[model samples]
Target chain A: MGKPPPISNRVRLHRMLAGDMTQAELGEAVGVTRHTIIAIEQGRYSPSLETAFRIARLFDVGVEDVFGWEEQP
Target chain B: MYQDLSFREKSAWAMGALALIITLFYLADVQPISWRTGEAPPVDRHFIKIAIATIVGSIIIQSVLAARNPKEAEAPADERERLALARAGNHAGFILAFGSVAALLHYLVHANGDLLFHGILISLLVSTIAESALQIFYFRRGG
Candidate 1:
């Protein structure tokens, strides 16, 4: 398995704010599978730029709001 | 884990299992004859049987899976899934190349064509199984 990306996301939180949207619903809205959404939410995988833009647009947030770099301390 | 397995992941598992079972059956059929003769046996009924079985089995299994999840079946691989597959395939390719090279070197020393053939064949099967297993692992690890 590959290392997890050094990124964090508020996708789950955004989903909750967006009418408690389910992962599958968000995935369909953003043209990815639910498993991909789950991986993004869990920080196990980083989204492509296109997917990141899609998620931000869906949640009406900037990419920075949806995702943040996790600096190693 | 099984319940939460995605359709693609399930397909990987099924294909891996099928590859293993078929390879084992092929070996069981051919190895004994090769051992009894202590010579390189030509391809015969077992080869034909395995070839037909693999193709037919894959079609049947894929049909059943597609029937169960037509939407996912039609879905293209996502970015992460594609990455995982590529990585798995890359490793499998390395294994195949290394095994083939080793088999050629062994043939140089022993000049036993039968051993070389069996070695290369088994390496191909192992490479396939390794690719599938690695895909399953990657899928579970969140690719």
Candidate 2:
């Protein structure tokens, strides 16, 4: 398996703040399956770099706002 | 460790088990005793019966299992699953090719066509087993 990038809680919290948008709709907008969206939110899978940008664009947020650097300490 | 196995994993397990049983059935029932009186001779008619039984039985069993989850069975492989299968198949092919070459060399020394055929066939069997085992391992290891 390919090495996965660090996790981000931003996507989960953003989805929740957007009136709890369903994972399926986000997946549709992001051009991936609902399962993939779920995986991303749960940190089991990280999206490709391009896909991550697509998701941020759809949400009208900066990429950094949608994803945070994992805690260093 | 990956805690849960996908549908493909379950299918691999079943297929592997079925393949093994079929191999044993071929060896035990289809293998003929030497017909030469008092002196041992080469076993009779190995290819024809094995070919028929293995082809027919595999088709039937795989069809039935696939029927149970037609969608999952028919689905194009996902990225991770594709990679796993390709790697496994690549590794398994080497094992089969090496074994077959070794067997052929042995047969060359002995000048035994029957032995060569059996050896090549057995290498095919081992390859199948190895591929399935590798699939199971990859599935568990999160690929």
Candidate 3:
């Protein structure tokens, strides 16, 4: 596996809060695939700015609320 | 197992397998003749057969995959998939360049046009296989 991106996200948490939304639902809402949603949730891939905003808007949260940077040692 | 994979990933796997099979078939068909003649075998009907097999095999594989996942097959590549594909292409370009240069260098020394042609053909085939492998890697590992 590749090293995880420094970005971290609470996409899964948001999905849960949004009536237990599935990754496919979120991906459909955000114009991506479920695999992309899974990648975002796992921090294996970082979304583009437009996608990030779309995801944040879908969860009714600020982009900062849904996403954050991991502290590097 | 295929249910868990995305359509693009499934396509990659299928294409990769096809390319590998074709590469092996090409080598098997040509190598014996080259060994016996002590020179690169001339391009002949075998190459025509290989071309026909590749085109037919690709169509069947793609048709089967698309028929199974029509929705996904129709969908355009999403951001992550696009990125992975671009990265895979970039890496594959390097492999192609290296193979081509090596083939050219071999030609410079051996001065055999037939061997040069075969060397380049093999390089192209190998690079295609490498591209598919790299795409699968990027898809699974995240680009």
Candidate 4:
């Protein structure tokens, strides 16, 4: 299994706060597939700067609010 | 079981499976004849038939898939999907080049023109299948 990316995200948390938004719904809003959202939430993949900005914009949050750098152990 | 997989992922799986099956069929048809004749088998009508069938079969499968999910079929691949495909193709290129070099070396040693042709063709088919399989793997790994 691949190690998780150093980036971490609160996508799921934001989705819950956004009136229980579904992954598919968010994906469509952000021009990505549900699987990409899932990967971002699970920290298995990191999005490009554009996608990151889109996601934050969709949630009405700053990019730093949605994503954080995970200090490597 | 694969319901969660995206349409592109499903297509990759189907194409990979088809390529593998076709490669097996081609080898089965050619190997024994080559063994018996001690030469490259005659370029048979069967080769053309199989080539056409493979192409037509892929188109039919892809068409059916697109009919089932028109929107997804029409959507272009995202950045991650494109990256996965590019990486897969890169690996497949290495495989094809290695196979070609090996085939050339075998031809130089055995002087078997028929085997060289068969080897290179098989290499092409194998590389294509490998590319699809690699794409599936990358997609699942979070592309």
- Candidate with best DockQ: 3
Which portions of model 3 show Cα errors greater than 4 Å? none
Docking class of 1: medium
What C-alpha lDDT values do all the predictions have?
0.87, 0.69, 0.90, 0.87
| Candidate 3 vs candidate 4, DockQ winner | 3
Question: Which is better, 1 or 2, measured by TM-score?
Answer: 1
DockQ, candidate no. 1 = 0.67
Worst 10 residues of 1 chain B by lDDT: B38-47
Model 1 Cα lDDT, one tens digit per residue, B104-134: 9999999988778878877888898899999
> Tens digits of per-residue lDDT for model 1 on A24-59?
999999888899898898888889999999999999
Summarize candidate 3's per-residue lDDT along A2-58 as a digit string, tens digits: 679899999999999999999999999999999999888888899999999999999
lDDT of 4 at A32: 87
Model 2 chain B scores worst on lDDT over the 10 consecutive residues at B33-42
Chain A TM-score for model 3, please?
A: 0.95
Query: Where does candidate 1 stray beyond 4 Å?
Result: A1-3
lDDT of each residue in B1-143, candidate 4, tens digit only: 67788889989998988889888888777777768876656367547856987898899889988998898899888877888889999999999999999999999999887778888888899999999999988887876
The interface root-mean-square deviations, each candidate in sequence, come to 1.8, 4.8, 1.0, 1.1
Q: Score the docking of each candidate (DockQ).
A: 0.67, 0.17, 0.82, 0.69
lDDT of 2 at B80: 49
Question: Estimated TM-score per prediction?
Answer: 0.94, 0.66, 0.97, 0.95
